[model samples]
Target: MTDHGPTREELPFPDYDHLPITGLAHRIRSLDLAQLRVVIEYEEAHARRVPALQVLQTRASELEAGAEPSGGDPSALAPELSPAPSAGSSVSPATAPGPDIPPTESDEAKPPMRG
Candidate 1:
């Protein structure tokens, strides 16, 4: 709790960079004031994610104003990534080869020089 060097991954919120506003709203309800403050500062320095930041700041204020932390069900949260398309919606690599496409084994496919 007192550790000062918290990173985005270390935050209680999963996928902090990508959590939806709704998910953030639900998750932050369980964090104590100190935790909420850390989230706010992390968001500000990283993406400056306004919606999540506003939600967290507001909750932190509520706690400062004497509200108690209401622990929420962390397991119920869903990932921000959308569900993958079912089988037919995607093209299999084995079936999609084109004559113009270079072979993956060729030296020409090597990555460009970075230096």
Candidate 2:
């Protein structure tokens, strides 16, 4: 609740306001107690979203219980925001249909395109 550390703008996760509850939960795991406090205070003053507050509080409790913060760059891009792989999708020949598979055909009874 105190303003002892970073403000909302200075939060460990720069995109905190846009993060979903699940993402917030994951990101906060790497924050220490002080950083969590900043998030909690900001949330209380702005959104006051109960779920987000709960997640922050839970992590604070874990830190209070002597759990060390997880290792990661707090300012790193969020997983959802990371650039897609340059190699493209995971789909491969094994996952695609084989050439032998017949393409679907319209019902013969159906009228042909008027255009």
Candidate 3:
């Protein structure tokens, strides 16, 4: 929790903590070994999530094996965070049921009260 290094806001993936595990896999493809290391350290200091660590370690391995950093934009909006077309809520007045009405006190059809 102490000042380990670059703050979460200063890391390659500034929104790392908020990002989903699946999204993280794609986003990390753009980070170089050094940037990825910083993120790994930050993750260990904070959440230390196993899945995230796995993804990061896998990328590090790839980098060590001569795999180049992906050409995708690291600063691009995460697919998970992007607004999906026609993804709004389906609820509307047309789908809602009509309001219920209470019975009047003078109604003759009222049933007798239970004991």
lDDT of each: 0.73, 0.79, 0.83
| Decoy 1 TM-score against native | 0.59
Winner by lDDT: 3
lDDT of 1 by residue, 1-115 (tens): 3354468666876566666788777777878888787788787777777777788888988999999888675434566556556766456777786669555776677887798
Name model 3 segments beyond 4 Å from true: 1-3, 82-115
Tell me how candidate 1 scores on lDDT. 0.73
Worst 10 residues of 2 by lDDT: 1-10
Give all TM-scores, in the order shown: 0.59, 0.63, 0.67
What's the distance in Å from true for residue 112, model 3? Answer: 28
CA deviation > 4 Å runs, candidate 1 = 1-5, 73-76, 79-115
User: Tens-digit lDDT track for model 2 on 4-88?
Assistant: 4346666777778778787887788888898888888888878889999988998899899999999997777887565545977
User: After TM-score superposition, what is the CA distance of residue 60 in candidate 2 from its true location, in Å?
Assistant: 0.5
As for TM-score, the candidate ahead, 2 or 3, is: 3
Residue 90, candidate 2: Cα error in Å is 25
Task: lDDT winner between 1 and 2, please give it.
Answer: 2
Q: Distance from true position, residue 82, model 1, in Å?
A: 4.1
lDDT pick, better of 2 and 3: 3
Instruction: Show the lowest summed lDDT stretch of 10 residues, model 1.
Output: 73-82
Q: So what's the TM-score on candidate 3?
A: 0.67
